[model samples]
Structure formats: C-alpha cells, structure tokens
Target: MSSTPVRPATSRPGAARAAGWVAPLCWVAVLLDGFDLVVVGTVIPTLTQPEEFALTGTGATAVITIGLVGMMVGALTIGTLTDLVGRRKALIGAVAAFSLLTLLCAFAPNALVFGILRFLAGLGLGGCLPTAIAMVNEFTRSGRSGRATTTIMTGYHVGAVATAALAIVVIPSLGWRWMFVIGAAPALVLVPLMLARLPESASYLLAAGRRAEAEDVARRHGLELESPPDRAAARSGGAGAGGAAATVRSLFTDGHARNTLAIGVTSFMGLLLVYGLNNWLPTIMREAGYELGRSLAFLLVLNVGAVVGLLVAGAFADRVGSRLAGMIWFASGAVFLALLSVRLPTAGLYLMCFLTGCFVFSAQVLVYAFTSANNPPHVRATALGWSAGAGRIGAIVGPVITGALVTAGIAFPWGFYVFAVVGALGAVALSVTRAVRPAG
Candidate 1:
C-alpha cells in the first residue's frame, strides 16, 4: 500500500492539469444524487391530482419514505462494498444500477410499483454520495478536502435545482413520467464517462494493497506518493477484518466510537432538514397560498441557495475546521429557519429561503467533509456511509413529518419551527465530536 498526498495545485501546474478530472467527474456523479433528492417532490403535485395519478397524501409520503429506506440500506452497505472492491467500481456500479432502476420508474403502472422502483433506485443512488465524497477527498490537496467535498456537493443541489426547474416545465407540459425519464437520461453519458475517464482513488488503491496501481494513479494525477507509518497495520486498529467489516468494527474501538455516534446524530439532523424541505417546500408554499408556479420556484430558489452555501461552507470549513464550521452552519440554519416562521414579503421570503438553504444543506456536507478529514483512508468511505445511513433515518422522517403537516394544512410555520429545532439539535450533536489523531 502507498500514501498519496496532494500538495497545492498552483505550485505544480502540470499536476493541476493531471489531477483535474477528479473534482469534475466526481461533481457530475454527485449531481445525479441531487436529482434523486428532489425529483419525487417535483412531480408529486401532479401525481396527486385527481385527473392524473391521484395518489393520496399517505401514498405520496410512503413513496418518499420507502425510497429513503432504500438509501439507508444502500449507504450502510455500499461503504463496506467500496472498501472490499474499490471506489471506482463501487461508484460506477452504483450509478449504473440507479440509472436503470430510475428509467424503469417512468414505466410503472401503479403507485405501488412506482414506489417500489424508487426504493430500488435509491439503493444505488444513495451510494453515490459517500463514495464520491470519499474518493474526492483522497485526491484533494492537503487541508483542502473541505473545498473538494463541498465543490462536488454543489452538484447535488444543482441537480435538485435543475430538477425543480424542470418540474416547472416538464411536470406541467410533458407529464410526470418524463421527469423520471429525464433524470435517468444522464446516466447514459455519466456511466461511460466515469468508466473511461475516472481513475480509482489512489488512497483506496494503496489501502487495498495494490501499491503499483496506487502509485500509477498518484503519478498520473500529479499526486505526491508518500507512506504512512506501518503502511498497513498503522491506522484503524490494524485493519481487524481487512475489509469493510473490519473498517466498521474499527470505528467502534480506538476512541472512534464517540465521534462516530455524534456524527451520525448530526448527519441525521442535517439530512432531516435537507430532505424535509426538498420534498415538501413546494407543497408547503402552495398550501401557504402561493400558486403552483411560485411554489416550485421557491424550491429552485432554496437549492440555488444550497449551491451558494456549499461554495461558502467548503472554503470556510477549510479555514476554521469542519467541525466548528458545521456547528456554526447548523446554528445559523436554525436562526434562518426560525425567522422563516414569520410571514414576509415576496422578496424577503425568497431571500430567507435562500439563506435557509445556505446553512441547512451545506451543514450536512460539512459532516461528510469532517468525516473524511478525520478518518483513516481505509475506513473513510465506511465512516461517511455510516453517517449518511443514519441520516437516511432523518431523511425518511423529515418528509413524512412535513407531508403529514401539509396533509393537515398546518405545514407552514409549524414545519419551519420543526426544522429549526432539528438544526439546533444537529449543532449540539456536532459539538460533542472532537477530532482524533490517526492510529499509529
């Protein structure tokens, strides 16, 4: 195994050029994740219309919850799979699985089948995020994992934003099935690009005992290949099981258990905020008296804020440390969300939605970045996947709670207040986890 560390790109122009593919390709991969996050929300209004699919509120909520359950299952399993197989293979396979399943969703004849298809697709798409984040962190310049992590995360919201915008057009004109068709369409290009152009993580290759491949990747990508102490048995409790199982077990020992638990809770809260709003913001707004177009517009605005937040949060995390940055982001999100409980003018509402987005969504990404920065390479994806898997619990709950609120016609201020509290709790959870030194 080898240790591949990246130095600043500016000093090595050639290295910068060589390593350029890591961020962009990973960004595209995460973009697909963003699409999945909001696609159901985007089409739900039409699905529930009596003239169309006519799904009941419970049915809609079930669709959203079931998909999240699949994501939870996927996140928990994929990390282990990535450690055993390889990041490249895990990511590429995940994308392929999701794309095919998502395409099938467009052809579902009933709500039950549609929800089932979504759950299956969620199994694949859920893996995309942690895998992509872990892979990007491995290739980034030292001390810049935050930037790389957040930069790629912007793609998630970009996909969300694009899906919402598409909903404004596609849902009304072409019908809701087209949204799934369009969502699946990207895999055709993304899968081939990933196979042809995406290199496996040098850190992953090294950890897997493929030194030659790791070295080759590092050199090709202008990474400086060094070595860690012991290079094999040094970090994460001597690689107990020597695969995904070992990695997961190591997190429970070696003083890692506390941080893992805290991060999981924080991720849960962060994702609760993210999924709750993404899945229900349009309906929530519409229930608040806004028309459908304006309601969907708010969803787009929220994600646009998310893109901005990711840009700001990453650089901020790089400077202040991911933990502090995450805590601050969660707290700030809480404030913004609390303020949203009060009625505002149209412009004020958009600004608040944008501001709420900035903090709420990026707070979760910061948790991923924090996980990446603190964990040993061999267990990084597993840790991230664990955090995300726990958060999937929150994701499932968020939409269900909000959907219930919407169904009862009480989602507006109450929903925002609920989110605000969740954000505050997330901050408290993050505050409990301090950094640790890699095992020697």
Candidate 2:
C-alpha cells in the first residue's frame, strides 16, 4: 500500500531500495519513542510551577521514578516476548500499549494518577528501543549494522530536541498537559503504519522454521537468502527441540556468561547516567541559578550534541570494535559530566552541556551495540532484552537518587559529580567486557 516493497534479505537487487524505506520507517518509530521518553522532562519545569501543576519536589521525583520502574519491567518482559513472538508484533504491541497509557497521562487527575499512568506508559516505552535495535541489527549487513543503528538512533535525539522546542511553543500556549497529549499522538499515526508497512525480521522467521513466510518476505523485498550454512544445517540436523535447546544453551556456553554479566553491568551504569541526567538536567540547572527558559534551552543544546555524538560514535565503532569505542566514548562522557560541576560562564556552561550530551547520550547506545556484538544471532534479542532490563534498575536508581539529593539541598555541582561517578563505573564495566566474543 505504501509503494515500498518488503525485501527481507541483505543482498537482493531491490534490497537497497527496500532497506532505504525500512530503515527510515524504523527510525521514525524510534523517533516517536524518543519523543515520548523525553517529553515528560521537557514538561517537568512547567509542572513544578506552583500555579501550574503545584508539584512538590518529592512528588515530582516519585512520578519520574515510578515511570522508570515501569519501563524496567517493560524492557525485561517485552524483550523476551520479542524473541518468543515476532519483532513486528512485539513492536506494534508495545507502541499501542504505551500510546494508550500516554493518553491516560494527559488527563491524570493528580500527581499520583499521573505517576501511575506514566509508569504504565513507560513499560511500553522501555520495550521499544531494544526491539528496534535488535530488528535493525538483524536487517542490516553485518558490516553496516553500527551505521544503520546510529543513523536510526539519531531519530531519538531529534525527537528530544523536538520535544524541547515543542515545550517552548506548546506549554506556554496550551499548558503542560498538552505535552503528554502530543506524546500520545504518534501512536495513533505510527501504529497503523507499522502494522501495514513493517515486515517480520527474516532472521526470526528463519529461526522459527517458517521458510515459506521467510521466502515470501525475501521475495517481496527482493533480497537473497543465504544458503543454509553448515553450522545452521548441523544445528537443525536434529529435531527442532535440540536446535532450540542448543540456541539457549549456547548463550551460556563457551565463555558467554562473563560477557553477559559484564554487558549487564555496563548497561546498568550507562543508563544510570543517561536517565539521571536526562530526567533531572532541567531541575539541576534551574537550582544552579538558570531561569526556566535557559534551563530548557540547555536541554536542546544537549540533545544537539547527542545527535553529533551518535553519528561520530557510529562511524568510529565500525572501524574500531564497538567495545573499544564505547569505552572511549563513555570515558569522555565521564570527563565532561565531571566538568559540568565547575561553575563556568554562561557560554561555558552551554558548551559543557553540548559536550556532555555528545558522550553521555551515545554511551547508552554503545551498551546496546556491545550487547548485540557479544551474543550470537540466535540469542541476540534475549541478551539485549535482559541486559536492558537489568540496566533499568540503575535507571530507576539514578533519578531517585538525583531527586533525593535535590530535595536534601545537595548542590547542583555535587549532584552532577555523583552522575560522573556513575559514568566512570560504566567505563570500567565496559572495559571488563572487551574480551567477550560471540559464540561460534
């Protein structure tokens, strides 16, 4: 219906054309996800205004933490569901779930109601990124995976930047509730498009022994199917039960367990920094003496830097391994985050915010990259799902701690320093994971 044919394989005559559309479509979905993810933060400053929402510090922080906790559950539960079901179905379901809940958030009667709805919305939101990342990685050529992922992920920053702009335009005119209302709008637009246009992951189909379906997808997309290799053939040589068991077992066999734990820890720290800063940056900066306008502007600048960082890291990760690049990028993030604590001129603060955004936003992305690289094709989704799921614990902790500190009268500089420590811990966790290799 959309004029784009579905080419499922990596190398077909029409593969490029089909991929051209697929990548952008997936990116758009991710953009919507990012938009909803950061929209609350964009609206937070307005929400905290006594005349507006009259939200207390503790109440505000509790709402954010509750949403993140919901996201944590969503990430773990939905991620595994993606492996069991198909990526396409799982993704659509997630979008629908989050969208409905976002609509609920727009009309919440109080902070308590808002917090609960946001939490439900967050579960859907949490499931989206890892599933999209896994789907994109599987769809692209091995060598091009990093670029494809990063390019797509740029949509996330773009969405964040857009939310900041929208906040400036919409919040003043329509009120903060309109922000959540806008967040729900995308689900309406995207869900129908996804159901009609998005295709099942070829890898998923093949793994499920749905060859006819796989072939149909490839034919529609004009892609070539790789001949079943010796490894695949041997694995399937036995009954389907053996192959399924072998796939699960291989995830832990051959030294993958240590790598799994390392990736989990790294993801934990990376998300801690990401969610901590993203959720609290405006509040932190406002307490640091910035006006509401200036604080929101800081968020825009940070996301601009995030766009740059994702592009740079994606290009670099392809050349050096994702592991090394992630380590370097995260280490750089730590340096910049630490630097943000120092009182600087207004211009200097903006510059530091930009630099911090560059490294901090992409650091979490690198965790996804590392998860993809460490696991074999069969268990890749599971690995990413569990890693991201585990990481949500840190995500939950970051905002709670930061908000508590703010409530306790901790200085902005010290709050940032605490985030910097988390970044450093991420660097160490990722570095330890460097030796992990995919199971053969």
Model 2 alpha-carbon drift over 4 Å, by segment: 1-13, 44-54, 229-254, 282-294, 434-440
TM-scores for candidates 1 onward, in order: 0.91, 0.87
lDDT comparing candidate 1 with the true structure: 0.82
Query: lDDT values of the candidates?
Result: 0.82, 0.75
TM-score of 1: 0.91
The number of the candidate with the highest TM-score is 1
Model 1 C-alpha lDDT per residue in residues 270-289, reported as the tens digit of each score? 98898888767766766666
**All candidates: CA RMSD (Å):** 2.8, 4.9
Per residue, candidate 2 scores C-alpha lDDT tens digits across 263-309 of: 88888888888778887777787787866444557777888899999
Model 2: lowest-lDDT 10 consecutive positions? 1-10
Clashing pairs in 2: 6-221, 7-221
Candidate 1 lowest-lDDT run of ten? 231-240
